[model samples]
Target: MESGKRKIRHEFLALRNRMSVDLVAVCSAGIFAGIKKLSAYEKAKTVMFYLSCGSEVVTDFMINSAFGSGKTVIVPAIKNSGDEKMYAAKISRLEDAYLFVYGIRQPEINSGNIVEKNNIDLVFVPGLAFDIKGYRTGYGKGYYDRWLKGVPFEKTVGLAYDFQLTNQLPIEKYDLPVGIIVTEKRVVQIKGDRGADRWETL
Candidate 1:
């Protein structure tokens, strides 16, 4: 099982690297559209978004757009050792950063209350690939999975570029799935608990 997981992660990372220029443009458009659609279902006043790296869908627009929408914006930064998952800290703007224990950019010291699991309203997740069933392959770190364990499944959304959508991903006992996979192209809802169905590429 460990070997299979490693292989899958390798192949998926290769797929991401091989993405074409045209695919990136289309995926970005799809992600913008998906975010528009998701705005309607959001009811939480405090929403969590993450900073992007590499080919992750650009979240700057979403973050700025959500600023005055009456919802407080929060971003996650690593707070503890690698063994501990990333933690969320409230921020008023995108530029603020503090040197957290893990050396990652985080909210200012004592800027806001520490994020308690399940206290979040909506969580915008970034990943390498996600199936229609909502199973996602991340950076081989269980950060989000560990942080979201007790949170209600309904509030989780995997935000990705369309190319990152895949037909299926290997699922393990500790691998938690998202409730919906949203790309710039479309939103794929997982059919059953823990995403039992094969993921259909967006």
Candidate 2:
């Protein structure tokens, strides 16, 4: 099962890396627009987002917009230690010289900026691939999955391009599914009760 996930991740990574800059921009814009229209996004008092890197969908627009939308913005940052863990750090602005993880810049992690798990109303996730069922394959560190375990599933969302969606993935017991996924073409909400899913095309 792990091997299957690794294979899928590799394929998705290659596909994402081949995306032209203009294509990424266009797709990311569409995905963010879909996110802005979500009722949950408007009502969210505090939202957590992952800063984009490489050919990944750009999230700076969403983060910047959140800053002025009267919502507290939090990003994941890590303190280098033997233990590999990510902390949700609330940031007033994006700055440099904090730390870098896999080419992605992260803010300084400290007690003052760490937000409580319950304070996050919405969390924008990063993944290599996701299935229609909302299960996602990340970089294998399991940082986001562990964090998601503590938050209400309905509050988490994944952002991806349309091609990143797959039919299914090998699900692990520790894995948690996102409640919503916004692609370049649509917004998919997997019901919290795991009943019927709602799909909205843009």
Candidate 3:
């Protein structure tokens, strides 16, 4: 399963990397529009957003828009400790971020404003690929999975481009699925209960 997931991850990464800058920009705009239309996003007072890096769906627009709308924005910061645990740090501006793992921008950990898991109202997850069912293949780090274990599935969302959506993906017992997937083309709501959902895309 790990090998299959790795292959799928690489394939999706290559496809995303091949996208033109203009196309990425256009798709990102459409995705943000769809997110803004969601009642969950509208009602959330505090949101967690992953900073985009490489071929991932761009999230600067969403982050900035959240700030402009007076929403509390929290970005993840990786700990250098052996556990490499992920923490939610409050970021007031983009300048609060610095290059972290794999040159991905992350908020400063020492900011002294870590947000509690229960305080988070919404979470926008980043990944290499996602199926309509909400199972996602990340960079193999499992940071998002571990961090999301405590959050309610209904508040978790995966942001992706249309091309990244596949029909199915390899799943593991520890792999956490997102409750909803927002793509440039459409928003898919996974059906059934939270953790035990059948992994069916609605």
Full ranking by lDDT: 3, 2, 1
- Please report, in order, the local distance difference test score of every candidate based on alpha carbons: 0.71, 0.85, 0.86
Estimate, for each residue in 70-177, the C-alpha lDDT of model 3 and write its tens digit.
999998888763555888999999988888766779876775788888999999999888875678899998888898987888899899998888877899988888
Q: Write the per-residue lDDT of candidate 2 for residues 1-202, one digit (tens) a residue.
A: 9999899889999999999999999999999999999999999999999988889999888888998888999998777643477789998886632547567678877779999879889999999998767889999888888777778888888999999987677889988888889998988877656544434343
Q: Model 3 Cα displacement at 4 (Å)? A: 0.3
What is the Cα-based lDDT of residue 30 in candidate 3? 94
Whole-structure CA lDDT of model 1: 0.71
lDDT of 1 at 103: 35
Best by lDDT: 3
Off by over 4 Å in 2: 96-99, 195-202
